[model samples]
Target: MISKDTVKEIKILALHIRMETMKAIGNLGFGHIGGALSITDTIAALYGGAMKYDPKNPQWEQRDWLVCSKGHAGPAIYSALALKGFFPVEELLTLNKPGTNLPSHCDRNLTKGIDMTTGSLGQGASLAVGVALGHKLDGRDNFTYLILGDGEIQEGQVWEAVLFAAQKKLDHLITFVDYNKKQLDGYTKDINDVGDIKSKFEAFGWHGQEIDGSNVIEIIEAIENAKQHKDKPSVIVLHTIKGKGWAFAEQELFNHHMNISRDQMEEALTVLSAELEGLVKE
Candidate 1:
């Protein structure tokens, strides 16, 4: 079981990721905030303690790898990486700028700790499966984590990868589906409903589970469960809200890719600051 103190730390880390992500995208004056913020908690859970990683040795052979299939959420990973010492925290503000290592999407060659580069939907799943199969064949126990956007699963390639992972019995490949209900065009349901995602994965021969993606404790515990299962790959459906942790963005239906005014960004930072203080004191 995770200690309460540890849970608090993870929670703080989640908030920090959200704040940093806002600052980074906000600095650009426009970026993928809604989708990015939705996965902050999951990223925090992974970087906080669920995943084994070394900031100084990012290429550590024993380390588990993360593939952000929904690559628009790169800022969230950048924020966590910076906070975990993968890079200077101040560099987060350089997101999407010229000559910046941090792009709007994740790129392994540019980023230090990113395992797989992704932007086009449904591709990360295949990359993650390949990595997991390779590690498993080498007798390595490190996990390959794949973070997929719910809407991205509409791609035929995603299901193809899902079938392949299950058939190979890549037990170490743990997948997270960000069911944020919104996508670029509009709400996922309105665009293309990937109905009953957990059921779909289970039918495809995966060990599937669902949980609150926003709660750090739940995310950590769910990951522990995913790690314990063997003989089949596991998929955790994370029910999340787009533009999560931000009061204004949460209410916007088309928050997928929206511009944040300077005033909105400052207000969000101020609110998060107080929330962080309260969490610390508690």
Candidate 2:
């Protein structure tokens, strides 16, 4: 178990992830705000407190892997990677820029710390399972972590991957479902409802748990518990709020995807700056 000091460290890192992400979106003026905000705590727990990675050599053979299945949240992942020293944070402004390596979707070959090129929705989760399996087969001790959007669970491929992970007993793999309950079109209930993902993964042979995705301490605990299982993949279905932090966006319907208007950008900046005032780095 992690000590209280370590838990504090995790919270600090999560706040920084949100800070940098808000700044990046503020720069872009508009992007995948909801998904980006929802995944901040998960990114923090992995990059800051859990995963083993080197800022200078992201492809180090012994490094633990991270796959952002909900790739639209690449902005948030980029924020954490930069803060973790994977690359210079200033390069974030070039996000989605023409000819820039940082596209809206993550590309492992292009981004120093990114382990997979993902934006195809349900694929990254499955890919993480594959990575874990490969490591296990090779007799390596590394772990694979992945995050998925609740809406993406509607895809058929995700279930196939779930079954595969369970049957293969890929215990080295862990996945988190960002249960923000809203997608691009509208609330998930109005769209194709994804019945309880926790129950689904559990039924398919996973050790499943649910937690508040925004809480760093709970997420860290979930990861710790997940690592203890020896014969089943573990999953934490994270309940979250779409467009969290920025109240205006948080209250908006379909904050799933949004464009930042000039006025809205100013408002978001004001709110984020206010939120950042007391955050300290560990």
Candidate 3:
């Protein structure tokens, strides 16, 4: 279990990743701002407080695996990876550039720390489950973390993955669903109501928990609790605001899947700076 100090570290790492995300995409001039921002806290909990990884050996056999089910949010993952020293922080500026390895979607083969190439939504969740099963079969003490968007759940495959994980009793897998209520088009309710993802997972024989995705402490505890329930895979439904820290961006649906404008970039940095200060106090 993580102590107060570890929880503090998670918050600090979250703030740093959130800031790095804004700066990285700010350099790219645009990217999936809303979704990336929404999952920053979970990313922090995983990278800083949960996952075991090495900067020098990203492909280490015992390293915990992370699959970005909402692959467009690769910016957040990249930021965390860079901060964890998987790569030089300067490379973040080259994100989405024609020649850069970092594309709009995460490609595991291309990026050092990414475990799966995931852009097609629901498939990544299934892939993460597969990795967990592989670990279990090999008798390796590794965990698999999969981060999915609420919109991504619209895909039929995601439910299939959820059912499969539960049926197989893949306890090593912990899935986080970004239940921000917004998707690419608009609110998730407007797009295609994903009716009670928690209940759905529970019905499918999985252990489901609801959490405030933006809360670092809640994220850490929920995941840790899920880890202990070995009868089934755990699914955490995280209630979050799409553009978590940016007020203007949060209100605009179009901002859910947009690049940063020059003015927006400045505003993002300002908000991030304030958030960083707040995190330091924790």
Instruction: State every prediction's TM-score relative to the real structure.
Output: 0.99, 0.95, 0.96
The TM-score ranking, best first, is 1, 3, 2
Q: After TM-score superposition, what is the CA distance of residue 117 in candidate 3 from its true location, in Å?
A: 0.3
| Model 1: residue 64 alpha-carbon error in angstroms | 0.3
For 1-282, candidate 1 gives per-residue lDDT tens digits of: 899998999999999999999999888899999999999999989999999999999999999999999999999999999999999999999999999999999999999898889999999999999999999999999999999999999999999999999999999999999999998888899989998999999999999989999988889988999899988899999999999988899999989888988999999999999999999999
Query: Clashing residue pairs, candidate 1?
Result: none
Tell me model 1's lDDT, rounded to 2 decimals: 0.94
lDDT string, candidate 3, 73-129, tens digits: 899999999999999998998888888988889998899998899999899988998
Per-residue lDDT of model 2, residues 44-94, tens digit only: 888876899999888899999988888899998998889988889898878
Q: Which stretches of candidate 2 lie over 4 Å from their true place?
A: 279-282
- Which runs in model 1 stand beyond 4 Å of their true positions? none
**Alpha-carbon error at 94 in model 3, in Å?**
0.5
Record all residue pairs in model 2 with backbone atoms less than 3 Å apart, i.e. clashing.
Answer: none
What number of clashing residue pairs does each candidate have, in the order they appear? 0, 0, 2
User: Which 10 successive residues of model 1 have the least lDDT summed?
Assistant: 182-191
For model 3 the local lDDT of residue 210 reads 97
Per-prediction RMSD in angstroms?
A: 0.7, 1.8, 1.4
